[model samples]
Target: MGNHDELICAFLLSGDKPGRELSWQEVQDWTPDQGNIWVHFDCTHPGTGDWLRAESSIAPYVLEGLLADETRPRCDSYDEGALIILRGVNLNPDARPEDMVSIRVWADSSRVITTRLRRLMAVDDIRNQMPTGKGPATPGQFLAKLAGRLIDRMGPVIDTLSDQTSELEEALIGSEEESNLEDMRHKLNELRRVAIALRRYISPQKEALRRLNHLDEDWMEEEVQGPMLEVVDRITRINEELEEIRERASVIQDELANRLAQRMGGTMYLLTLVATIIMPLSFVTGLLGINVGGIPGSENPWAFAIVCAMMAAVGIGMFMLFKKMKWLTIPK
Candidate 1:
């Protein structure tokens, strides 16, 4: 492999060495006659855009795509080459896997140029294969291998999402406590959000690959189409799995919400019954406490005891009446 810091990675594919790394100066001096070459670049490099436009002689539209700040999964082809944008799950440290990383590629018969703002391990995978004769030998093979790598990495991430969804569903099923349902609800929503984001990119990327595979460009050899189509089918399956995760999450979240609502309603029902029982007692105490001389209990020495006894009876009576009517009982 070439110096990653210097040229990102530039390799010449020739029969003698199979794949040979090239320096920055060597890449600048490279020609079609030298050999079919693959170059991977960190688009953030200060000289990348300039070198692409000037020395590399990349067309304006193609250069724009290679250096664009934002892109979605897509494919476009001209007479000479095809430009493709594909997204892979973000597996970088401290990064959420749903926040996918994008790779931009331009490939023809003689050259294949790939760019990325973030590190795509799939590129590293391709470079690793270079030493072996098993590495990509043509532009079509390069696209196929890189695409296969990106989709392959998505498999574990999609599986994890499905597993989490299943766990949450099981937790909800066996649970009797409403105490942690709120927290479970939050977790469920987060899972749904991640599934949606992954599906958004994967669905479109499947279409992008399908479009690229069907293009009439000479660069896309017949043998490479098999791998490209495999990539399309893999992404489509990933998309379907994500959609299933979202649907399952939604159902679990709704169940959690219903359980919480039932608990809240039960609490409110008890509070209402207590308030009803206290209302009449409050009115009696307030009326008797008035300072008017016509108050009946004010002159009696035992009036305080009698009033307390009477108030207790009233409270007891109310409770009995509520029980008889089943108003104090919680419904199933």
Candidate 2:
């Protein structure tokens, strides 16, 4: 709505109404004397004392086209009726985008009106599912049906995330190599972001529905109330499961980091030991090689063999000392 280019809002009135569709411009010039039940669309401006009114903060022309962004899902009710806000899912699993499709619906006894800043999959899905010659009888019923389908669509998406999380857990257990660990970490973070987004968007709408359930409005009948409650319950459960998955991912990340650190420390210790053993040997060889003066065993024909034997003895002694201190591990 902020900077939207084109807005289109249409209303489908009750069967008794003369015209099937009424545009905002038409409503502005329309006179009630025409024997028509008025259903106005693109009426985003603040209302005066009209018999039935539907308005939006979003630009009116923005409702009818392809949406290039994403919006968080939400729901709200006014003094006269209800408003449902929904975000469309991006089915491409690998693509991460902040923009989402948004649909806003406002309804009353005689009319059902939908407005949007961008095209959404759920909106289209709901429109397509509407049976011929049987449009929504009331706004509440229309909203309930939309909410139910939106929650149901999320089932497959949540299932995919759960399966991916399980696969990551398996991979982590089987291999703790850097490459595998990094990949798993990336995937887990992505899943966490999706879960967090879903929870953030859907929570408000769930609360809205709960409020609607308590309202004394006549339009909110059993057909509307029952499905709305079910959708809310499903969303609540999904949010809880998402939290659990996030915790597991965090635990996996911490464990991997600790394991990597320990492995690095062990490798460093072994290298230091090897370097210490070689230092003394290098000194002994260098000093004995000096030809100028009294070098012990330098003049002997078997001096080289004596040097070799001496080095071996020193090496073995150091090895034994290290073994005693529990430095070197012997394979079983």
Candidate 3:
């Protein structure tokens, strides 16, 4: 491909057996009379918008969608062609899975063009399969296959979130260490954030896929409906799983908070009990230590011993009274 050709790869499918790659010149010269074609483009490339706006014979709305800066999952029909915008979990290096990448598509009976800003592994997987002569033969099959691949990649990421949530729940239940609790709390919050973000896009993407499955496209026939429905079902399952993970994470957080509150209440009760026992002893000592002329224990050495013994007795009595009142047991 030339620098002026943003085409990452273009396949001129001869009944699913991919022929030689098409250049920008060839793509521009191509037409529906030349069998089915699939063109993949990097929309961030400067040449892409120029070629799409000037050369491609797609509708104005479809062209706008292909070059859209941001879009949610949706499908719009125009004549026999369908314009679709879908999002997949970001799998790029150093990227969070929740930062989903968007793919825009314009598919008709004979051509399918897809564009994206970030590299999608699902797109690569299908592109790779074409070399083996074992890829989708028609535009409908290609759309179904692409949807399947996008949803398939989400399985591992969603499962990882679930596993992390489970681990956090177990840790919260089995451990009382402050540092460990903090770590688990942090992980839980991160998991929830990831799940929420994933669901944010995946939910709409699911609806979009469902719409595609039901779309009245001449290229997408009864033969393609089964696979398209399967893709829709897969997306539904993924969204349901994300919902479960989010709820479980929330439960773990609440449980952790309750446990911490109970621990704190017990600690505060014990401190209060200690203060209660010392208060009277402090008052008694202060009263007996006065050096005024008529102070009770000032003259006699025996009086000092008596005062000390009495203070000790009062301390013991207060402790015993607290024990009887069950104040030291600490409420749960």
Candidate 4:
């Protein structure tokens, strides 16, 4: 939409009936007698800021927050309403869930205004259900349902991370093959990045939900408290689970590093053993091959065979000594 058409969608809800769409003109003329109103806008649109400044009665700080390009999850309560910020997994095609999408909402007893940079599936879900009379009937229900929806979508993403981490842990235990560790390292890094990113938002999101649940507004009804608490609890669990996943990724990384070091140590030990045994043999061969006629092997072919046999015996003796010294075997 353009600046002149800033609204993405508007809804008018009645406790006695289902919600219906409201046009820009209707939204501008909406009165408390018309039941609750929800106006969703694409904040990036050219005229969105102008419309909010000129039409909405929201506080200056909340207005600035809603129009801002970036915001963290938070809730600021005001006498008129509360400016609440929340985030949901970026479920859009090609977008990573770690790059969460923010949904800024200003809500009170009778009106709600939400803005976003990208489409949120949770918002769509509520919009779709409103026609079926299954949507929130009041401003409090709206906030609670929106919070619930945002948290519900997060469950699957968190579960996926946990499941993948568990599988990696199993793989680490079963085998530490070089190629497998390489691939595991890549996946573990990605998982750690995702977990950290998610925890960054989810932690504040839980607090935001709690604040919304306890908002001082009359519209924040007692019935909404239960669902809001549930949302907060779920977000809290997601944060804790993300931390676990991150720790597991760290363990996987350490184990992989240890395995690589062990392999390298074994290879180095074998190379060192070969060099140790060959050093004396090479010295003897070089000394005998000297151009000086005093060299004993120069005149007798049997002398060459004797030297070869002696060198072989020396190599075997060195090998046995190394085995007995336990240098040939990897340390426990």
Candidate 5:
């Protein structure tokens, strides 16, 4: 059942019947009985089922395998239910690579099925909360638990990003170091990408949950609705926060770039000014060094000193002119 290509689905029987995990063969052989809920995972064809279906190709294991290196977050819905996909952020405060984990889940009234290519904190958090004695009564409740866990996991990640951004902003104010700017740009871009991916899923998930709230199915119990609504509200709030973070990151990036460009422009301006002042002196020296016998300064020993004095005077005069023209700025 743990085979890479094997699919495993478990069913929790209703009433007082004992819960049993069934393999695909056992599920196919069993007769349909009332109060019995079935869970099936088909490794070869996830698309062949009725009521609920998840293609192995789209199953979490398979999808994770295919998109292991994919970092983008997204959300989509299918005929069976809704697919909420998102990237979970790594919140290590140390400067580490920003690795994002992708989550894909399908949910309906009777069952919630999840697929992922990698282990994500949100999934593990919910799994840890599952009761040892009993499984959730319906798929919708399971989904609510998962969503709530996801929102909970997001808090620390967002807080970490916010802190890092604030620190970068302060650094920008005090230091002229380009490294700080570069790091800020890199982090901001990564944050923006993650936010965009989250938006892709969180936005649609809000609507999906709204639809679920009004669904015609009797399988959704009153006990689960409260939690489900709470999950939806949490998701909406998180989405808003992510959007705000994205906007702030964008502004910071732009400001950093502009500051860098200004510094570069100032340095270039100084270089150009120095070159302008040196041009006349270079011409004088070159003219004096010519091979011709009639060169103006070559005949006199004191001529070299005179020319040096003239060059110094010219440089000073030009510096004063530039100062008067207000071309130089005081370093802040």
Candidate 6:
């Protein structure tokens, strides 16, 4: 684990034999001439930093980048090795997918070193495949495989956002409930935010992969170039899909806002019509309350009944007039 003092894993790769795990002592003693080695470390570990500073002999700038707390996707070739930083969706328990995790790599022809504060499934996939003699045989192939896995996992998450947006759009088409519309509005906003966050890393990562594929290096030879090109294509599509999802979410959000506004406007209009029809009837009744002698049949027992009947007829007539003028109807 990145939080621990131990090196995560160290493997000595034998092209024909299954990869063998190396102890800390063995890692310290190993060299390029013995065999190609892959060393993974928890960057946060104190021991890891001390070892890298004293033994790794990495350039100051590259070491700083590898140990930095925050980094965007990028590739910088130094000497014979390349320092690669890549981001993958955070798929840990209780984690938000949009909060991507980054892993840093320093890879050359014979030796590959990787560091991360957080564990990535893509790294684990490489670990699993190595023991079965089916994993990448070279540092270049390893990077390509890892990039592909990161992209492969992203497909479902992007598809999920697209599906949710579609479902919300359909619900908006059929939903008459104001409450449901309000809920959809919140969901659409959240979905759009996630899409933007995912794109933040993905866009830069696409460029990084492109630069890596085109870099003139011995390690990035013919066989490595082919797999890397595929990785570049996949990330490109992931970026495009995220953009589409963002646009679709925005359209749905706008449509929802307009519909909710019309609904509220129609309701308020109906209320205004009711108040208009009642105003004169209220005035007629209020007139009887005016203190005066011989107030228009106030002494007669039938006066109250006549006033009630008159108010009823007036209200009905006003309602019918409003209907005829289309004031009582709301446009669909």
With a 3 Å backbone cut-off (N, CA, C), the pairs that clash in candidate 3 are: none
Candidate 2 has an lDDT of 0.59
Report residue 168 deviation for candidate 6 (angstroms): 2.2
Once superposed on the true structure, which residue ranges of model 3 sit more than 4 Å away at CA? Answer: 284-309
TM-scores for the candidates = 0.94, 0.71, 0.91, 0.92, 0.71, 0.92
Which 10 consecutive residues of model 2 have the lowest summed lDDT? 46-55
The candidate scoring highest on lDDT is 4
Worst lDDT run of 10 residues, candidate 5, spans 48-57
Best by TM-score: 1
lDDT of 6 by residue, 1-332 (tens): 23346499988766457888887888889877887888999988888778888888888778888898999999988776899999999898899999999999998888889999998888988888777887776787778888889888788898898899889889888998888988888888898889999999999999999988887778776897888888999889889988888888878888887888898888888788889998998898888889988799877899889989999999999889988987877744
lDDT digits (tens) for residues 135-252 of candidate 2: 4546666666666666666677778777877887788789857777777778877877877776676566567666756656677777777777787788788667767777877877
RMSD of each: 2.1, 6.5, 2.3, 2.2, 5.8, 2.4
Residue 332 lDDT (model 6): 47
RMSD of 3: 2.3
Alpha carbon RMSD to native, model 1 = 2.1
Per-residue lDDT tens digits for candidate 3, residues 205-299, read: 98899899999878997898998888898889999999899888879888889877888898899889888888988888787667677887577
Candidate 4 global lDDT: 0.87
In the range 178-259, model 4's lDDT, one tens digit per residue, is 7887888888888888998999999988888888777877888888888888887888888888888888888888988898
Task: Write model 1 residue lDDT over 264-290, tens digit each, in one string.
Answer: 899899889999999999999999888
lDDT of 5 by residue, 28-139 (tens): 4554343334343332343433223243224454344223444344444444455545555544355222455556555544444455554566655544333343445456
Better of 1 and 4 by TM-score: 1
- CA-lDDT, candidates in order: 0.85, 0.59, 0.86, 0.87, 0.60, 0.86
